[model samples]
Target: MSDIAIWLVRDDALPLGQRLTAALGATLYQPWQTPGDSPREQFRRCFHQHRQWVLVMASGIAVRYLDGLPASKYSDPAVVVLDEAARFAIPLLSGHEGGANALAYQVARLTGATPAVTTATEALKPLTLGIGCRRGKPLHDIERAVLSALGTRGLAEVREVATIDLKADEAGLLAFCERHALPLRVISREDVAARGWTGQPSDWVQQNVGVAGVCEPCALIASPRGQLIVPKTAFDGVTVAIVEDRPQTAVRHEP
Candidate 1:
């Protein structure tokens, strides 16, 4: 049996729970499975038995259930809270020491949900790359485009790569991410259309992809509080934009 447990309170979320179970090789637990036990009892049992947990329910409910079960960051299970809508995957506990942040990113990649990781280590990362390219563009072209955009910066400062969902399975993009070991975050077309970005609109993108533009919008969406440091720069067949995360403001002392 896998060490990961996926828990859901509602019947409606069962489908998503099952999908996660299959993807993560996790065991699924629902209230209906054990009629004799209360929901809390079932959750408690799974909580102690599993090393990692994916909770498919409201954040409030997950918090209430997890109230006293946690021991410490060192020993507590990694807990990720996902909503029924599957819009966001948030790492609720054990963000670093227990791997909740990594689990959240994996869940995001699997379900196309945005990973809302709030850990300081991740939040402090400087840049996110937004890329768009023609289908079948080679890894070298994509790498060159990204490197050209980075100029003085190195890949180490990039937190992740952002792109439209259409390119989520693009071979070259996947290869580039794999080569650099960077997490790829994909934004849906619907999300791209809904979000406001300042990049020059592209007729090709609008007619073909049904979005205003790809690179800038995706970078802005991936790092919601970030600013585009490098606007859309085009190579032969690829476009790349770089967004820098807003730096934390230092508190000023009255002298």
Candidate 2:
């Protein structure tokens, strides 16, 4: 489970905070209940303690508590703010890399509120995971290896999975992708080779798969504008690769 800390400062927000804790399986911290630490101190402690934080209070209060701790989006913890009424969830900081937008969407789904997601990538859901494994590899092993590799970069959600066309009908790969609710993309060998992957070369892979490595090339081909965030990492005959879609630059027309 991702490390999450849910904070509540008002009695009216208690039920919603508890619901989030139960639905999302997060740690709920009520500073009043603890009765020792100041609100700012509690916020600082929670910020350092968790990867994602949900503040169940006014947005201004949330902003004030986080006053001096803002870091770059990639390194900062995701922060979501919901009013005491829980009518809406807003991803206040670190919307994409820190996963605040996705967390807000999840909170809205559970609480019957609206999620105000402003991040372009989170709205598009363009990330994909590329995988390769030996025949009959266990689904659990593939899942574990992929999670382990992606967790290092703080990316847990993938919109889809890509692999060579030869593995399209592979039962283990299909099952693994299906279990995660991600679409499976089967890439042709020619498409994989065109990407010019720089991953580790293997004689056995070249002989069998017609490519240097399956995971790296497939990920690159599937997400053309993406950068390989995590390169091919192998465990127990399963290899996992991650690619994140790069933010597109806006083109201005000459007036």
Candidate 3:
């Protein structure tokens, strides 16, 4: 078995992600296709076969199955979804917090397909993960390290502008914050787009803030004018309509 495992739906033709799997040495588990298995029962069989690490599911079937499980049961395996063509790579389930994000980039680089990333912190550049997740939560050493890594010269300003539909396994970010005692500012999408970012952003979150969790303590909201920096990721997956951004209540302060 490979370091990462994928539960896939079997099909004809060279599936889009087969090359990626071969390259990554991912163990492909096709429980549904096993003989004597009932199509109706595939959900159960697939569920029983699930393990930790990264999982690349084929259709909404897996999404519904996993979502039905309680949130605590989410051991937070990095999850990515690939359409039948494999032309598009979508990190729907555990994108950033779970490590699905980096995995998506890997798949995108290998397949030459566009990664459909939709996190806020990643859209902007030089974001601070320590400040995004736990707003009031203090991050001590981790804050200092992030400031040093990003080389933020001026004072730090935070705002929670808007919220995106965020679902991540924030272990790395949470660790950084706890060590440093960093405080996050919450804002709105309209706020991010209304006002340009002031402080430095982290490299990871800069890739795609709204699609990527780079801005942890903040979400990246975009508009015709520019972008807004929200405090948290989006809630309620149904409404991509996004929220509005008001002036940042927090100013340049600790972290």
Candidate 4:
């Protein structure tokens, strides 16, 4: 009877569903467990009773089941969809108003999946942190480098963390992003090499990582419409840079 419900149609998804249930403190509902009621009926009951939902199945199935149930953004429960592979956590409904976007991030943190947030509010967030570190660098070093780069800026302003795809699986970087609840954006090495960067290139990086630089170019690529506020700064063995998006001013129309 938790406020959150996790529904899975397949037995294969049960493990992930259980993990999500434990992490999110949600009730897991399965087909066989529905007493006398059909899975769809159970889904309907959960939909109305819960404040949030995690649907672990194909998006089409979730959509088919949810077709006529959504009442309003304000009243409808937030819904997050995850594939059986658990590679992506998507906020399928009520992204901004119903807290699905935040829930998706939480799921990603728990599963090491990527949170696919499509909301304008999340996209327009001002700051992006670009980070690079040695292989197997511990979380504390990465955290220190990022904090130093942030300086006076707070973590709330940060939209995402950007890193070269080579470092996408870096444990330290992942831990830092998870700790801060920041989505990690992985930029391809080719894209980073093709882009222009401001700071002096690193010889070691050129030879070892096959890139001229990691932090600044990653920040630039991740925030295409942004300006680099902090150049590449190193702490221990980790490098960190920050980018800030140019503010958009809305036009006021005179009637």
Q: Which lDDT tens digits does candidate 2 get at residues 1-255? A: 449989988767788878889888899887887778797797786687788998998888888999999878988989999877767789999987788876776676566445666676544675678888988887888888888888855433576677887787688887886687555666667767777584787677789987888988888876778999888899889988889888678987899
Using lDDT, rank the candidates from best to worst. Answer: 1, 4, 2, 3
- Report the lDDT tens digits of candidate 1 across residue range 153-180: 9998988899999998899999998899
Better of 1 and 3 by lDDT: 1
Residues 1-255 of candidate 4 have per-residue lDDT tens digits of: 898889999888899999999988999888876569878877876688888899998889999889899989999999999998988889999988998988887687667566788888787679988888889999888887787788898888899988887887799888888898777877777778888484979999999988899999988877777898999998888989999988558888899
Task: Summarize candidate 3's per-residue lDDT along 23-85 as a digit string, tens digits.
Answer: 778766655557786543654444434333233445465567566642532455566666556
- Quantify how close model 3 is to the true structure by its C-alpha RMSD in Å: 13.8
Residue 157's lDDT within candidate 3 is 31
Q: Model 2: which residue pairs collide?
A: none
Candidate 2 to native Cα RMSD, angstroms: 12.9
Full-model lDDT for every candidate: 0.90, 0.78, 0.43, 0.85
For all predicted structures, in order, the TM-scores are 0.84, 0.50, 0.43, 0.62
Q: How many backbone clashes does candidate 1 have?
A: 0
Best-matching candidate per TM-score:
1
Candidate 4 or 2, higher TM-score: 4
Best by lDDT: 1
Cand. 3 Cα-lDDT: 0.43
